[model samples]
Target: MLDQFLWVIFPYLCVAIFIVGHIWRYRIDQFGWTAKSSEFIEKKQLMVGSILFHFAVIPVFLGHIVGLFIPAHWMSAIGVNEHIYHLGAVYVGGFFGIVMFVGMFLLTFRRINNKSVRKLSSASDMVVNFLLLFITFIGIYATLVTNNIVTDFDYRQSISVWTRGLVTFSPDASLMTDVPLTFQIHVLSAFLIFALWPATRLVHAWSLPFNYVGRSYIVYRKHKK
Candidate 1:
């Protein structure tokens, strides 16, 4: 029953909240949809942290998509065995995980240390940063230490299938019953993060300026004096 709620009910609840909260925020507070960038207050730290975090996170995001969405059979079909995949996952994922952790730490430090930036930051900013740090650090530890030294649990068979089942509206909570405690915490933390996304600066992700593309450029003219 505990696993049922954590794996099935909680995930669905988080998704529902994320969707509804996003709609409500967009309708009632569209103007507040920004990352609330503090680049003006301190560009150096922001640039270094933001760039490093984003670059590293892109691969991490893609890795999750491939790991969770793509089945183990698909990789095997493409000549990638479990050992090969796990090796790559550990090496590559660990590298970026460390990079992302460092970057997030720098950003969090900057926000806390810089008076102007700290003043400009909201409670949500601190919450999100702390969550990211926790999640990323756990992930790195899981990949680099736990998986490498102790047990290299291939989540593709269990966690991946479970996630795919959730997408198909057929979540099997039993799949997660045997998953490692560290991985379980990581998954739960991710769901919590998603639930908090709509209320935080993450809403900016939905408001990309894609409309700016294919538009005419502004022209400036000097008046004769």
Candidate 2:
């Protein structure tokens, strides 16, 4: 029942919100868009934050994909132990997940508490980071407490079925309620964050290569007569 409702509701809600968010927020104002280029950019600090964010969270995302999205039968047919895969989901994924949790929290709080950074930030800025805080918190909790739920229904199985549906665009609602309330919160938070993505600095995620190319150029002065 719970799974069915989540399977039906959150998926559609999240996807719709995600689609509409990009449409509403994405702007192409190359001609007029301008911000004062910072002369005091702190390369070292930004690099530290980015490293933690990417390295820690990225593997977690990948692990979730494997654990939640792939069918147990498919994995077993290929001779992989589902428990091993699930452990990767908890320990490996959860490690980076925690890294992301801590890294993002530090970034968020730094933005809030630092006077210079605070003055320059907006309500939207707080909103964006706060969203991340909620999502990651719930994710951590879900990963930790899932084993405590009645051990009858396997989380990996339900997650796999749901994820497969997510990939195929059919979206299974059956898995949502069967798991646990904690699981539902994780699902809802995930969809909400996805829906909220385009509206926040989170959009930086899409502008990868050009955004962080750390290249420096040398200019030589030549006199023009």
Name the 10 consecutive residues with the lowest summed lDDT in model 1.
Answer: 145-154
Q: Superposing all C-alpha atoms, what RMSD in Å does each candidate have to the true structure?
A: 3.5, 4.8
Candidate 1 global lDDT = 0.90
Clashing pairs in 1: none
In the range 5-35, model 1's lDDT, one tens digit per residue, is 9999999999999999999999898889899
| Candidate 2 residue pairs in clash (backbone atoms < 3 Å) | 2-177, 3-176, 3-177, 7-173
The CA lDDT at 49 in model 2 is: 57
The TM-score values for the models, in the order shown, are 0.91, 0.78
Tell me the whole-model lDDT of each prediction, alpha carbons only: 0.90, 0.69
lDDT, candidate 1, residue 77?
A: 100
Backbone clash numbers for all candidates listed? 0, 4
lDDT of 2 at 199: 57
Q: Which portions of model 2 miss their true places by more than 4 Å?
A: 1-6, 27-47, 166-169, 210-225
Best by TM-score: 1
